[model samples]
Target: AFTVDVKSVANKQIPCHPEQKMLDAFLRRGEWIPNSCNQGTCGTCKVKVLSGTVAHPPTPDSVLSYQEQEEGFVLTCQSVPTSDVVIAVPAADKPSSTGHLLRDMTATVLQMQTTATDTLTISVGIDEPLEFSAGQYVELAIPGTNDVRQYSMANPPSQSNVLEFHIRRQPGGLATDAWIFDSLTAGDAINLTGPWGDFVYDDDDDETGMILLAGGTGLAPLKSIALHALTVNPQREIHLYHGVRRSADLYDVEFWESLARNYSGVRYVPCVSREHWSGRTGYVGDAMLADFDSCRNYSGYLCGPPAMVDAGVKAFKRKRMSARRIRREKYTPAP
Candidate 1:
């Protein structure tokens, strides 16, 4: 065992087992580091190691670059302590959460349906109701294995007991092909660990407008955020964009279209990237660029594959939007 010292508002130390990742060790002790895509792909769980050593895999050049690794930066999700370590946590030390923290619970599958798109919508009822912010995700533990797959909740915080998830069927995916799409069925009990992630919508921000950009099924968290935003922040303008290969890949068109029609400040645009369409036909970032001359007045929220998120960020910055006003969640495929 190694003692991991976490520093932010105050310095606190906890014991970390050699086999355990730093994130699992710290979160177990109620230390929530702002993180998304815990697979070491998004770099959101990165923390500077001020002292000592940790064993971590070589993350992609895009995430923890060689320069960052040389600067003692490590993804807490992938780092395993080899010696007592002191880490600099940038965010304030939060004591778990104000609401219900995460726990291992048995969840029973309630419903599963195929939508207009290739995605699958799964609704499961948990043994206990967990209070979570919109845009947070849950990990589904594979039976008889240590592996778990993460999926963002499609439901808002209001639906605490009945957790909903939108999953894009990956044919070769272990969780999807071998388990979820193949063998999983309604009434089947599965182990769940959640409500995790920090990619939540900031309803309290003074920004009068916000932009939501999503690719494929990356709309999961954004859907939750949109529902929460419309419910709580009625006055703010919400411009949502969902980018897919073709119109066939787009789901929930009616629901989003209805929201735009009913809510005066809401605007939803579904963009197609791979096809030549009469409507918006381009990459998600390009679609955003075409509609808005400048993004300086709005807060931007992007969720998608890393490439899509990167493109959106570049577009927003080029449009005079400050980098601080832009937030993103990257859905990394399970490796």
Candidate 2:
């Protein structure tokens, strides 16, 4: 076991096994570290190593640069402490003495529909309503199995007992194959917990316009945030960029189109790649870059696969967007 000294939280010390991830150790000790994808793709759990070496798994090049690695910046979610170390975590990531409350509730599947060829939308009704912030996710455990998968809520909190999720089916996936594809059905009971996530909308930031970027089913959380934003502040300037590989994958286009047509404060830009579509092509980031010369006045929210989120970050940075004004969540395959 290796000792990890966290410099930001009153110099707390935690024990970490070489085989365990540093983030897991922090979490086990109820220490909060900003993280999204536990697989190390999001770059949210990054911390500065003050005086130690860490052994890490193979991280995507886009998540951490070589220079960052050399400078002792490590991704806690993917790295294991090789020796006793001192690390400095950002103040924003410090957990409260009382951590966020987590609840486990029983939900009965209300309906399941295919929104797109590869995307499934499932609505569940919980016996007791779950109070959660916008842009949070819940874990659904497969009945009669140890398998559990996390999916963000597509519906806003106003929906109360009714929660919705958009899931992109992965062929032969453990959860998909056993439950999501065939075994699960309407009225079936499923175990759920959460409302967990840091990618949340800040209602206090009324003056700063929001730029929401989403890819594929990553639209789930962004949709929740957008709707909540509209409800909270209808006059707020919010732009949504939804990207998909093909035109066929553009689910919820009609809803967004209606919003764009009727709401002056809301704008929807959908982009398609890997196909010739009359709409914007190439990448969603290209559309975002073309829409604004500078992002200094805007707050950014990004949720998607690592590649898409990373590209969006680079594009926003080129437009002089402050890193502090941007929040992100990256999606990766369930571990």
Candidate 3:
């Protein structure tokens, strides 16, 4: 095994097999760097190779240009070490004593239900204790293959061992149609690696009110955030809006209503776009524009399709909200 050196890490040296990805080796040793998408599509895991050789795989020119590759920059997620190497971790990824480390877990499917017209609510029980921020996600391994899919945790982090996810059906998705929907069942064992993401609420940002906007199953992470936020400060005013094409496509309305019933500061608004209903009917961004004239002291958390997230950001900006206070995660259908 070759030794990989991370300049930012105090350990200085870590073992890495020739066939293993550098990031996987680092994470296995409790060393973490700033990362979002682990598939190399997002350049969040890119780092400067101070001194080392790696078998870098083909990546999108848009994400890792040839010029950058020549300059010893590589996406650690896909780069495999060839020999002893030294890499510079990004400055933002300061090691945290209390942060959750990447874990490989074997879980038994505890429950599964169709939460909406195209969404499935799944619960899996892991034998080991898991710790994660409220709005983080996990990667589910596809049996008999190396493929893995990312899904946000729907349940709050307090429910650590048993993770919940709201998965939307992608008509031709291998993970959904072929595996999760077609074959997965209660009691089935599955492999997963997790506790990834940065779109979470923290007490440090408790000064502003919250505007949680979600589209379709994007409500998962926001639900976790809201639940944790209320736990930290119940009286913190929160406006949560879920936008879907029709009422049938909506799920968890009752859950949100229950939160509102118990917590006086919780406001749940269900929005229907293509169907007429006795409730709010329009795009989520438009609904937010109608509800709040000025989001001066409000923090926005939006998740969904890219268009919806972009529109939500635009609406929030229009309401005089600052860009730094807006957090969003975009979901793309598996291809």
The numbered model that scores best in lDDT is 3
The C-alpha TM-scores of every prediction are 0.87, 0.77, 0.93
Error of 1 at 280 (Å): 3.1
Residue lDDT tens for model 3, 1-335: 99988887776797999998887777776666666677878787888999978997787889988898788889988899998999887677332222577878999999999988978999999998788887778899989888899999988777788888998888888899889988999999999997776666755678679999999989999998898888778898999999999989999989999999999999999999998989999999999999898998899999998899999999999999988788888887775
- Weakest ten-residue segment in model 3 by summed lDDT: 90-99
Model 3 lDDT at residue 208: 76
**What's model 3's lDDT at 73?**
87
- Write one digit per residue (lDDT tens) for candidate 2, span 43-62: 87899999977988776669
Q: Look at candidate 3 and give me any clashing residue pairs.
A: none
What is the lDDT for 23 in model 1?
85
Q: Of the candidates numbered 1 and 3, which has the greater TM-score value? A: 3
Q: Model 3, residue 141: displacement in angstroms?
A: 1.4
- How many backbone overlaps does candidate 1 show? 0
Per-residue accuracy of model 1 over 193-278 as CA lDDT, tens digit each:
87778788775554558899999889989998888887876666999999999888888888899989889989989999889876
State how far residue 266 of model 3 sits from its true place (Å): 1.0
